[model samples]
Structure formats: structure tokens, C-alpha cells
Target chain A: MNQRDPLKRVLYIDLSRKSFWIDDRVDLFERWLGGIGVAVQLFKEEAPKNIEPLSPENPVIFSIGPLTSLYPLASKTVALFKSPLTGNLGESHAGGRSAIAIRLAGYGAIIIKGASQLPLYLVIKEGEVEFRDGSALWGISNANTVGRILREAAIGRGIRTIMRIGKAGEKLVSYAAVITETYRHFGRLGLGAVLGSKKVKGIIIYGKHSIPIQDKKKYREIYDRLYRLAVGSDAMKRYHDLGTAINILPLNYIGALPTRNLNSSRFEGAEEICGENIAEKKLARRVACAHCPIACIHIASIREPYPDEPYFYKTTFISYDHELLYSLGSMLGVKKIDDVLRLIDTVEAMGLDAISTGVCLAWATEAYKRGIITINETLVELDWGNIDNYIQVIKYIVEQPNDFYGMLARGTREASKHYGGQEFALNFGGNEMPGYHTGYGAIIGYSIGSRHSHLDCAGYRVDQTIKEPPSPEEFVELLIKEEEWRQILNSLTICLFARSIYNVENIIEALKPLGYNYTEEELKKTGEEIYFEKQKLKLKLGFKPEELKIPSRVFETPTPHGLLKREYIEEALQHYIKLIEYKTLQ
Target chain B: MYVSSHEVKRLAILDAERCVGCQLCMFACSRRFGDGGLAKSAILVRSVGGIERGLTVIVCRACLDPPCARVCPTDALKLRKHGGVFLDQTKCIGCRNCVEACDIGAVFWDYETNKPIICVHCGYCSQFCHYKVLGVEKTI
Candidate 1:
């Protein structure tokens, strides 16, 4: 009860015994600064390097940063675990009431360990933790339906976070994700499968306590300034109106939108499922995380008559984004918005990652055409923009009906290896490729990023400079530097979209009002340290950048700039390995 | 500067569709009285169910010749000429009279003070509404 607002209070949940306890570890919060910073330290301390990601020994750590719930845009929560798919350090970030609720619940982080005997849900309110029976809610198809049930069952409606797994999670799909608050997600590296392995159906957390501020006047001043800037800014307005789906047309036109298993960089029918189209034709609503001014999550309501019966109609509310549009729309040759929406809905209902699911399907389609997977053996024929087939295929992936579905559910790389099509696997570091097909930077970023993610290094953000390309050595160093600093922001749990507003200086100033004291240099150093710790974990887990396979199909396809030679990519990756090794030595 | 209930004034109105649930109005209301949090806030911004369902902007609608002030148990709730009812937090016991009397349900209760807090239509929230969701006008 005497704990400071931001200091670390660790909530430990033991699923095997159905017991939980809170332990205050002020040192953890004080030194690492919470979120990924604390999570990496904890991951190193608790989870062994040799443990299987889906095993009971693998610990799931969810942490929020010091600035979370204290600043306007610092509303993200970081979830860290060993990836079920990648077999390396796994981390995912999500926004919603998750961060705010975790902070307000008076805990810096929640550490979940040991698999349960039966389906269960953990409900945390204020300082009390309750283990609720979730047998009735197990194996639910729709992720949002769980939200409604949790909303009614839990105490907090407007203030709490409801994070749940769907059918894909229940079936232990390695690429499944944990969906929170209907739209937000612990999106990558199979966190949902981890939760499913432990039989945790959902976690609902809520708290209502006033936090202490360093200076009330100063806090109010900074809060007001950030609030005004966030609400009135043109950047935020764009996000509010069209959302991230706006990136579709521009990325497609610029030849960076990743079409047809990433063999082609342009999609001819990009406009049909673009952000503008979604906004004008199908956008039913927009939602935001707790305290976020920019509500970018777009939900579309589409009504159609039943296939068997004309009299009865089925109305489905599906969420859309540029990444999914690229992966499912253009990549799968899905020109019709309704087809793409249905495909996305199927993925969401099963709780599989839309990007990974689409890319996996894309790889399967290519593999099928090449006779690697035959129509007789498959549940559905893999084809472009075939919603009916896509729906059946997703269900099969979730169910892991046969050897092919089981391998495909693991990810494209494993599936490709099993089916003999490594040339078009479309995976980097065992994870499916994100929707960025920009040159060297994105490729190098995915190869070396601590989390093997697009947002980790944001190499695509500086795609323009990669036209001429940098020397292999220079590129790796620059990528490391950028990724390290980004670790700092993500640890702070700040939304990346607000990067312009909450620059290092602004972040420091903003944190001062909330009782944090650190110079920009110190913060950056902390971030670098955190990033290196994650690298150490990956190295211990037998990760070798030298061994990563760059799909051969990329070399044959000439991009907008020119043909991307395979040797250049190899050289860059070699440089990456050397840089990481050099950093480790230092 | 002492504007009483008899002084000539105006009222505030809000278009709910324009509200982004920024909670700026709640902050502005609490700030005017020199406090923070939902406890002191008069205007409330709560989502109808989820964020995708939009928001419900709850505040005093300022009924023509108010009934909340007239039905006050201990003469604590008073009619402000600017619009709506104002409560003298120190004057009344926590009786649930004015709460039921109002049709629009604008009378907000503060748990800490054990008193009803009503919007006075001073329109301080407009300063914080960067989206221009609120409008304040004078009645001739």
C-alpha cells in the first residue's frame, strides 16, 4: 500500500496450483525502467535458454513502462516469452486498457508460469487476484464474443482490459495471437498459443486509485500540452479519419506493398481494399485504446444473405488494416473487399495473426500450384482470393488436421521445409514476413531485430536511403542504433505513431512531472542495454544470423528500383552477424 | 465578477456524434473547481459499450426553468441564470431529491464530498475541446 506509483510490483500467477501472489521488487523497476526493459531482465532470470517455448517452464511476462498511464501516448504493454514459432526471444506490444489497467492495478508487471490442468481466467481488480473457472468459455470461436462475456462477468466495463485467446490459441497454433479489447492484440510470436498451452482463457484487470504526481501544476501543464497536440495535430487527424489502411495505396504505388508471396512488389487491384475504400464503403466504426486520442482501429459491418438461404442474412463486423490488406488482399489476389473481409474475419475468429495467416496461405497457394500439396490431400485448394477455400483452410490450420496443417500452423518457414518449397517461404527468423517489401533496410531489420519484427527497427521508415544501399558494415550498425533507441520508446510503452511528439527530449520533460529523473543519454544507454540482453538470450537459444535463409524468389523478381541481387542480402546479413558479435564482446 | 443566479447568461450544448471521448470536458470541469479526476468532474465521457460504439456525452442540458433547483431538499441546489443547477456542497445532506427531479440526469454526484455536482454552463470545457464538439450560446 505504501508503494510509489511507478516502482515495480510484480504479480506472480501460478496456473498449476491456481494460486497467485504479488511481490514488490523495486530494484527491477528502478533499474530497468519497466516494460521490455524489465521483461528482458526477468526473461533472463526466470526462463531457461533451453526450455521449449510452449512448455510449462516458459514464463509469460507482461510489463508496462514508467510512463504508461502517466503520459498521453504511453499506453502500450509489452508481453515477453520464448516464441512457440521462432524458437527464440519472443515479444509483442499491444494497446488498450491493458497498460493503464495493469498500472492502476498497482503492479509493474505480471509473470505467469506453469500450465494449468483445466481452462481458467485470471481476474485482477485493485490488489485482489481471483482465479475464475473458464470451462464454459473454452474453445470459443469469436474473439470479440469473449470480450462481451468478460465485460458482463467482470467488475470494470470502461476501465478494465479483457485479453483472451480464440480457437487458434486453444488448438496451439504457433502463429496465433492474444486479442485484447476487441481490436488490440499481443500480435506476434504466438503469445496466444503460449496462453492456450497454460489453459488461461482470458485475463481481466482493473484498478481505480489516484497516483501521486511530482508536481501537480507541472503535470497538468505537460498533460494539457500533450493532449492538445495529440488531438489537434494533423498526423492524428489522418489516423482518426482513414486509419493505417491509408498506407495501402501509397505503398502499392511505390512498389513496397508485397504482392504474391513477396515475388511481386505491386498489386494491381490495390484500390479495392485500400484504406479509402474501407473508410468510404465499409467503415462502420473507429475505436481507441484507453487514453489514446487517435482511434485508428477500423471496424466494418457487412451484411449478406446466407449462402444456403436467401431469407436469412448474416451481418459480420470485421476489422481491416493495410497489413492485412497487403497480406490477404493483394498477396492472395483478393480484389473484392467482402472476400478479404471474410478471410480476415475467419483469421480473427480463430485468433491467428492475420499477417502470418495470410502469408502462410500465400506460401501454401504457391506450394499447391507446384504440386507440393495436392488437392486430394488438402482440406481446401489453395488459390488467390478464394474466401470459401480460405475459410476452410484457416479452420484446418487451427485444427492442425493433418501433417500439412500442423506444419503450416507452425509458420511458413517450417511448412516450406516440410513441403520442399524453401525458395518462396517468405519468413525471416522463423516468423512470417510483415507487409514491407522495401529493399535492404527492411530485409536487414527483420534479420537482426531483437524481436524479429518490423516495428522493432522500422527499417521501412527510412526506405528512401536504401535505394543506393549502404555498405554492409554501415547498414548493420545504423540498423542496430535505430533498433536500440526504438527499444527505449517501446519500453516507455509509448505508441510509435506519436514518435514526432514524444521525442527523447519531450519524453524526458514529460517523465519529470511523473517523478522520473534521467537524462536522454542515460535513457538511450538503458535501451541499448535492454536490446543487448535480448540478443544474448537469442544467442543462447542457438540463433545464428549466418544460417538464415533468404528466399531465392526475391532475387529473380526485379523491384521498382532494380533487381535485388542475393549476394547483397547475404553480405548485409554477414555484416549483421559480425555487428551483433562485436556488440556482445563489448 | 460575482455572477449570481439572477445575472443574465447563456447555456452550453453538445453534439454527441462529434465527441471523440477525449474526456477534456471532464478535466475542464474538475480544473475549474481546483481538483482532478472523475470525482470532481461534472461532465462525463463514457463509451456506450465499447470504443467502436461511440461515446455518450453526459452533461446538464439546462432545462427551461429548471426543476432540480426547485426540488432541492435543503435549498442546496440552486438555479444559475447562465444555465442549469449549481450545488452548495456544504449546505445539504446526501438526500436523493434533485437526482430524481431532473429529466436529463445531468446532476453528477461526488463521492468524496457526498454532494451532487451540476454543470454551471461556464463553458470552460470548450477551451479544451480541440475538435469543436461543444457550442455555448446566449439566450435573448
Candidate 2:
């Protein structure tokens, strides 16, 4: 409410002009708050209607909330961009130092626009922006190497975020990811390809500043309360114990695992890549974000025996979670945990979104099995669980040795469109599917949600737990409510892992000392507003509910619940449209 | 060493191996001084390279006869009872002499007002340290 609000200032950078400035948009922050709520408004203003996703006009908006750096688990940075993968509203959240750095760097949001003529990496430090030449760093295949080079070049340590792309982004793979802080990522919906289109290699932001709390005593009280709950809660405690990969065995046992391109929903080799196995066999270390007490980032030391040397082996460090395990392990029929780890490592190094890559490969393998194509088209044989051949295909996807590999690099939707296999492409709204195959909940959530992301709706929880099967209309209504509620989480950019602790009342209370006074009713209204605004943005961008593709494989596959019927899903979709229309009229 | 010290109540890295690099200590230290952020944090935790190798918890060693105090041109940093340096901010010119003189790089600069932020040997941060990597010990 005051002119001294440093957190309200949004840093704007124009790569084409090589110009940068800070815009004090206190009014926007006042009305929308920060993170996704503010980011969506900025994206609407910056990205022209129906702008090509890879065009210079598309904007990249990274935002953190007032709670950032002031509380535990307020540690996620929301990135909003037009997805090159989906061609719709794009949003992703990443942890590590991204939020902490941006918040401490003294900005509420950063909006980068326009493509540069030459390769450059923007460095923000000490209240200034410098476009460092990235010619030498370009074409370096590994994302880790890019992070390393940038880390050395960047001045500030302990409080800095280094975000960069790798071979996939450089090659304009539609599902490329932007790796941040080496082990974390803005990993979904082709944010990296969008950055690649701008000719920007990466961004390094570092600063030393503080957020001004309105009431220090109340702040400390709330901080300790939240910290205690965060560490003490049983449900939340599992995040650090086995990490999210703990879901593998349970999900597989329940028959909701989505193995081998959804030909089956359970995998036989679940234990090999399951959480307990990975933790006991390979866990190298556990790390946390700057302000978070939960060290959820689990890195594994994957040691592989050399082919030529009988006794020699090489160890590689790779971060793994449920999504990668599902996408690369069960989904691909990768029997060996080391094989899944190696594939994950390859995806990380190449900066490819593992979900899309695995889904694309799965679709290809199935397509090949049905004689949709031959070895002449795919230089390497497309076989399930064949790590050797899959590894070659992954490299081929990045390098694009042939037409099939090039189409596969684009993503599942495009690849299937070209070579046949539309029924089992397994992409929702043109973005690759996540690791959930619960039932209608996951299907409706992924197909009809704002970003077409499971996190947006998280209906898998509803599917896995609900005893009574609700009506199709009720299902649609529940998903809408779920998504609208998640607007608050993504808006605060809080990690969904801490959803139980970040209840609406707790959120409102958390905002008080951080200088935001919001009532429970007001927060709910704000969440609905953010949700509607994103839906409106997507509608403007040609995302049509009527045209939403429902993959038939989802219907054929028997989930933990039962067979998901196409007719039932369509009924839900129809109900969802009517509900949104009614909300719009109101 | 402080000329009149009887017992040293200084912060110690009791076990660096226990650190998960959450950096709650940084925010806790800053909060103790004033606000709830890292601007005033004197202690730091960073990965040795990647997080795979683990954390390097860097803090003022609370050196006996601290070089930061010796290099203070304005005598702004006086030796504390626990072997750390305490800054008299009114006397500090923001010349960064103490920041440069510290070999361990524990001296942090506050960018807003441009002053060297140093730990005063308080163990307020150790309370928030869930990993128990830090402690307040009475050392001889």
C-alpha cells in the first residue's frame, strides 16, 4: 500500500533491444497479489493475442509471492509462458534458489520479452542487468555444463538462480525443459524452446535484499508455527523420507501406474524402480531449497558397469521422482532401475521434459509393434525396455537423424499425427501426459484443466480415494472446484507438496505479517478470479473444449478403479463446458 | 581473544554432515536482527559444486583476535566476549575493510544500505536449524 514496496516492482527485459528496466506495478500486485495471479495479468499484457509460441512476441513471466523468503515452503517460482508444446497457456513451477533469489533480488516478478539477434545470457545482479555473450556456451549439449559455466561467471553465491537450456532447447524440441540450479527445473510445456526461440541461453539472477515484515513478532510466531507443522506433519514428512518416488509401488499395486504406453496400468518390475529400492540402493544425497526445511530433492548415484572393462564402472548423479519413474521406467517397460536412471540422466542432460520424451517413445514403440512403421523409418529399433536402442533413439530425437526422429522430437501429438497412433498418443491438450492413470479424475483433470497438467487439478487423489463414484456432472464440478482452489497454491507459487499445511485460513494468516491482509472469502474470490482469467486467456489462444482430444487408450485401459469409458469422459467434458459458461455468465 | 572473556559462548559447526542446506538459519539470523529475510543473514550454505556433493556451511569461526576487528579502520568492529566481532554501525563508514579482511568469507554485505553484516556470536539461528548442524558451545 506504500510507495516503499520493493516487492511490487517488476523487472522487464527486452532482449531484441538489449534493454532492461524495473516497472513499479504496485497496483497490479495490490489487486492480483503475486505469483500466478500477477503473472497471468502480466502475460495478458505482454503476449499479444494468438501470438506464435516460438515467436519473439511471446513473454516469459517468472513471479514469486509476498510469502517467499519469509516462510517455509513459500519457495516456488511460477513461470508463465505460451507453451511451445501445447500452443496454449503455459505455466510451470520450480524450486531450488529460483524463488528465493528473485525475492531477495528485490523484485516481485520478472517479464522477459522479444528475441535477441545473437545468443546471450541475461545476468541480473546488484540492481543492474547485463547481457553476457553466450556464443561459446551455445551448442554445449549438457544442461549441467551450462549451469556450471554460468555459475562460475556469475558473482553472487548462496543466493542466486541459474536457469539454462540444453540440446533439446537448442534443437527446438517442443517439450524441452529449462533446468535451474542444476538439479531443479521449470520442467514442462516447452519453456526451454520458447527461451531458445529468443536466442537467450540462460538467466542468472543474484541479489542481497530483505522483505519488510509489517509485524515482526507475529511474523516470527507464524514462522515457527508453520515450521513446526511442516516438520511435524506425517503426510508432509514422507516428501523427505522417500521423496515422491514412493508413489511407484503403491500406484502399481493399485493398478494405476500406466505401464508400457497404457497397455497395462501396472508394472511387474515396480520394485526395481520403486522408492524403497532406489533409496536403499542408490540415494546419494538429499537437498532442500533455500528457505524450505524439507529436503525433498533426492539425488541418486547411478553406477554403470563399463562394457569393455569387466571390473570398472562409472558413477553418475541423477535426481529422480515419481514422474520420471513412471514416465521412463514403468511407461517404457524399463526393467532395470539403472536403465531408468540412465534415461532420466540423459533427459536431464539434454534438457528434455522426461514425461513427454518417454510418452513419445512409448507411442513410437507401440506404433512400431503394430507395424505402423519399420526400422527403415526409425534408424534404431523401437522396442519396449530395450535401454540400448531407447538410448540411441533419445539421442536421435535430439540430433534428428531422420524424419521420424524429428517428428518424435516435436512431441507425441505431432509424431502420432505424422506416423499414425493417434488413439494412444497419450497427450492432453497437446501436452504430454503425466504419470497418473487413476480414472476419470486424471483424464478430466489433464484434458480440461487450465494448463492440462495433473497438478492443476490433482484429481488422481479423488480417483484413488473416493469410495462412492459420483455422477459425471458431479465429477466435472469437483474438478473445476479443485482447479479453482489450486489457483491459490499456484498463485502463491507454493509447492503443492505442502497443500495440507497451506490451507486457506493459514494462507490468509501467513499473508498478514507479510503486509497482505486478505480474508478467507477474499482469498477464495481471488483464486476464482485467477482461474477464470487463465481460462479466458486459453480461450483467446484457440484452446477449444469441443476440440479437446480424448485418447481411446485411456478408455480401454483398466485403472485401479475400472474401465474408463469414452462416452462417460465426453459426458463430463460436456458438463464442464456448461459449468464454465454458467460461471462466465455470473 | 577478548581480553576479559571467562567463557566463550560462540556458535559452532557441531556437525556439517547433518546440514541439508535448507538455509533456514540464514533467514532466522536475519529475522533476529530485524526482518524475516536474508539481507541481514551472516551465515551461508551452498553446495560444494552440485547438491550431490553436499553442503558447505560457511559462518564466522568466531576467531580469537579476529582479523575483521583488526582491519576495522574506524574501530567499528570490536572483539566480542565469545571471540566474534561486534559492529558499532554508527562508526562503520561502509568501506568494507572488515568484509575484505575476513579469510573465511563470512562477512556479508547488505546491498540496501551498503554495510557489512557480521554475526555477533548469538545462537538465535541454531534454534531454527532443524538439522542440528549448528550449536552454541562454551569453548575454552
Candidate 3:
């Protein structure tokens, strides 16, 4: 920790008091290494236990890392606050201009506490912050247009970050996401709703200041070496070529695509939704982060003909990813490219999480079939690859007209409980399942991983490697190591796909140019310490493994390998919990 | 290999309709400065809405007879024949006159240096533009 970067200055803004102050907790940044590490420490300090997530007492903590603006793919800014959805630790990371802007604006972190009486947006320039009225932007249904208006009004167009929530957040939907730069998002655990609770419409920030480097010459040398690897690597090639949608065919071929609410693992029309298909037929262009050479963001154009008007038409561009394809495409039985695009657009317009939205719709569809929620009670029919009806359902998820739809807005777990379809709720830790259906690693990782995210542990890779299912102990051990290493990667704030080209030694070398003096061993230990700290914070905040609910639907359907027994998953979860605890002790 | 000035240089123009707002060009531009951060970069990339609607990339187009240099109060902005304006930070004041003069708003200001950070069109940012979103073709 002696050779660590200077502590980032913390900016605390109290909406209730309409005041702001700075806190330079150097020790916290040096000890934890920023992002989740610092955020967790700050979260425990600011947001005490038993406070309502949407209350004035709750604090929303936004954090970035030391490597931000100094390294490629280290563009994600992590948000940590109590969840409006799970009533637990709600953390989401987004890549856009957010991380670079926050770092350049001269702060490592910002904590917003209390609630404003009226809707407002905060603008941070240089070292000063301003509170502006957002009455005009209030209740805007379209999230995409909001970003454009803010962009036009801001001093820095490309360099600044404009984070705003749409109707879903304004409505206080538990799955609402904070949209940044349009394409990137802090998409899960309802950070949008948390912002809405504070009556905060948006955050606009931009700055141009140099980050003090320890060794200028060495920093340049090391940075160039890693930069070349990131921009030129084979792993990054596909991302640049087609983005994340490329995983569709490969994942589908492996029988891990999760089609039709887990009833089948493979989608018959998987090729149509693959990255290659989108790139060839629909892909308009590729995009990247402020300091990232990996332009992995893919935008697709969907031109639709008017039903009645002649020669009058509108073209809508939509973003595609593996999760969106799995949830809205395969899970909902959507096959047509246009249909999938429309569904994704609807989700974004409503300011909802596409993965969760798709999963919720899937659950409702199955529930309707089982005589749970009647046809009249639901707004739209849940048919696979049905774009028009799915769009209507997405709108309802945000608006939540009747009691049934309102209950469903809370997420799959809450919706399933009320409607008696807990068996196939398709959620872990209150967040809906991601696209992966690889095996034990994916399930166990979702069940026990900190964020209940595929990225948290990425156990799917482990499952893909094993021909025979590993024993419960073996599976648990593999996930533990994966999660531990990932903790290090996240702390470094680099994208996980660069794991092949950049190892611990390479990362240390990369930082040497920036003037960080840490050996490979030191880096590993640092990663381990940060990982344990996050777990401890989660546990202290009341995260319990025994209390996790496993949806019954997964057990009934046979995955690609074979039928998944309830006992196997339970056994794996039990071992995984113990392993996590054991690692924390170490 | 000599090129004439009369022909238009087929530089990669960003069709905002196709943009995903990824900002990869921003990082590529920052890399040209041989530094790690967005502070020194000339290019800008940002999202429209959750990526589906696309992104916007902002950089100097190297305008012919650049207005940034013409309106400079302190002779800080200098126009080059090829395109773009070279900014002399030492001679300049932080007046932002050139920023207002340039119709495209390509004249960027570095807050820390209190000077304009215009694009030099060094072609290094093009190396990272693997998508071919940026092209550095010669004018005939």
C-alpha cells in the first residue's frame, strides 16, 4: 500500500441540505484501491443498516479506479448503494465517459445523500458542482433523446458523461438502469430508481486535468505495451468485429443458450441473433470508451415500413448483446431480427434492464400457460420471437397498470411468489439470470457471486472446459479461484476479455510506466485482500447463502448435458458458500 | 505519389446513424499523445441511448481555411494547408473566441492548460479505428 496512488478526493452532496463538501480519504483509496473496494468502505460508513433504499438517509456512492483514464478498457464507474430491488447490496458498473469524466473532474468518488423536493440535475465542471432545475426533462418517456439534449447543453460533448434515467426510474421500478452515453449503462439493481428517489434527473460532468503519475517515462513505456495488446489481440478482434452478440452461435451450439425460459438450452434460430448476423445484416458501426481502443460496442439499424402511410418511414437503430439476444430473442421466442431490435428498443425507452425485463416476461408467459395469471389480466401475449406484443409488455412492466403487472415489476422472484410460479422464477439474488446456461459454474456463480452476475465469476468458462460434471468440491474450488482472480482484474478496472494477453506480471509492468511499484505477488495479494473486503461488506450487510432461492423451473428441464437435479445444485451451492467463507478467512 | 489539392480527401466521416457511441476513437486519439488519459485527446466518443440508438464521435475535420485561426485574439490558432489549426498555448489567453468562431466546435479547450487542444490529424488515432470508421486518404 506504500506505493499506491494518492487517495481520490470524495465529493459528498446532500440534496436535502443543498450543499456539498470534499473528503480526501487517502488511506481508504490506498488500502482498498478504489471502485468496489472504496465504495464498499464508503457504503458501510454512509448507508447504515435498516435504512430504506429510497429514503433521504440512503447514500448513492459512485466510484472509479486509479487506472481510469490511464488505461484501456478501464472505463467502467461502479455504483454502490442499497438495492431498491433486493433490499441488499446494489452495485452496477458501466463503461462510457462516466469513469474518465469522474476521474478527470478531480474526484475518485462522489456520494449523493438526501432527497431534493423537486426534480433536479447536478453538473460538475472542474472542481465546482451546480444544481440545475430539470422540470422540463422530467417525465420524458424517451431515455435516448435526454442524452442528446444534455450533450447539446454541455461544455464537453464527447469527454463528459450524461447519466439519466427514463420513465422506468421515474416510476421507481426496481429494475431501472442509469443510462450513460446511450449505449453503456449501470444496468442492474435499480440505480436509476435510487436516482429517481432523490429526484435526481441526471448527472453531467466534464473536466480536463492531468492525473499525477509516479514515473512518467516508465508509465509511457508500460502503457504502450499493454495498449498494443488490447487493440491488437485476437480475443478483442471478435468484439470489435461483431461485439458480444458473437457469443450466440457458439453458446447455442454448446447447448447453453437458454431458450424459452430454460425449457430448451438451444435456440433453433440462434444464428439469426448471433453477432455475425447482426454485423453482416444490421450492424451500423462499432464504438468504444474514452480511453479504450477496444471498440466493442455494436449498433444495428432497423428500418421499418409504415403500415398506412406511403413512402413515409422511420429507421430505428438498436444495440444488441448476448444477454439481450438470450432474454428477449431466445427466451421470449423472438427470431426475426427486426422483432428482436424492436423489443430491445422498447426496453431502453422504458429505462428497464433488458435481461431482467425479458426474464420477467418469460416467467409471466409460463405462468399464463399454467393457469396462473389469466390472459385478460396480462397486457400482451408472451409468444417466442413476438416483437409487437413483447414491446407492449415492456411498456406495462414500467407503467404497471393492474395489480398483476405492478407485482411483476418488482422482478421474477416477487412476481413468481405472488402468482405461485416460484419453480421457474429464473433469478438469483433477486436479479434475473444472464444469458449463460453452461453448467454448474454458471448456476453456482449466479447463486453465490457478489453481484449474482455472469461477469462476477464467469463460471461458464469452467463448465465449458469440463467434459464430465465436476464433483461439488471441484466445482466450488474452480469458481472460488475464478472469482478471486476476477476481483483483481476488476480492481485493476480492465475489461475481463483482456485476461489472455495481460496477466498479473503484465499488469504490474503496465502500471510501472504510471509509476506504480508493485511486483506480481504484491498485485495478487492486493487483489485477494480487496476481494475479501467486498465479501465481508456483503456479509455484514446481511447477505446469507442459505437464504438464496433457486427457481424450480431449472430442475424440471434437461440442459444440453442432461437433466439437472435439485440435489446437485443445492450441494454445489453449499460447497460454494463454504469455499467463499474459507477464502475470506485466508 | 504527389496528391493535388483540388480533389476531396475521402476521410472517414461518422454517419451518426451508424454510431454506437463507444468512444473508441477518443482513446485512440489520447494514445496519439503517447499518454494514458482523455485530457490531451482530440477526438470524442459518446453514446446516444444505451448503445442501440448509436454513438457520436467528434474530432476536427481539418477544415479548409479554418476559421479558428482567423478569429484568434492572440494568434494562438494557426491554420495549416492540409486542415485543422495548431494552437500555441503560450501566446493564447483562455478567451474561447476560436471555440465560438469554429462552426463545427472542433476547437477544444484544455481546462488544465487553459488553451485550445485542436486535432493535428497525426493518423495515429486511425490505427486503433479498426472498424474503418476513420480513413486517412489523400486528396487528389
lDDT leader: 2
1 or 3: which has the higher lDDT? Answer: 1
* lDDT for position A256 in model 3: 88
Could you give candidate 3's per-residue lDDT for residues B1-140 as a string of tens digits? Answer: 21232343434554545444445556556555555456676766644433444556667877777788888888988766566667776889889888898776566666657777787766666655645667566633
Model 2 per-residue lDDT tens digits across residues A1-586: 3345577989999998999999889988898888999998999899666799899999999999878888899899999999988888889989999998898888999999999988999998646899989999899978888888887897877789999999889888888999998889999999999999998899999977877777788988888899999999987779999999999998998899999999999999998999999999999888898789999989899777899989899889999999999999999999888889999999999999989999988999999999998898788778889988988888889899888888888888988898889999999999888998998899999988887889988888899889765988999888888888888888787889999999998998888876778888888888889888888888888888888998889989998779988888889999988877777666
TM-score of each: 0.91, 0.97, 0.91
Put down candidate 2 lDDT per residue, B1-140, tens digits, no spaces.
Answer: 22122455788899998888899988888888558668888899988876767789899988888999898889999887757878888999999988889889999888767889888767888888888999888856
DockQ of each: 0.25, 0.73, 0.38
- If you assessed candidate 3 against the hidden native complex, which CAPRI class would it receive? acceptable
Residue range A349-433, candidate 1, lDDT tens digits: 8898988999999999988888988986476777877779888998999988788888889999888887788998888898888
Docking class of 1: acceptable
Quote the chain B TM-score of every prediction: 0.83, 0.90, 0.78
For each candidate, how many residue pairs have backbone atoms clashing (under 3 Å)?
0, 1, 29
lDDT of 2 at A340: 94
lDDT of 3: 0.78
Per-residue C-alpha lDDT of model 3 across residues A413-473, encoded as one tens digit per residue? 8888888888888999898999988877788888878888888888777778777888877
Q: List the residue pairs that clash in candidate 1.
A: none
Residue range with the least summed lDDT across 10 consecutive positions in model 1 chain A: A1-10
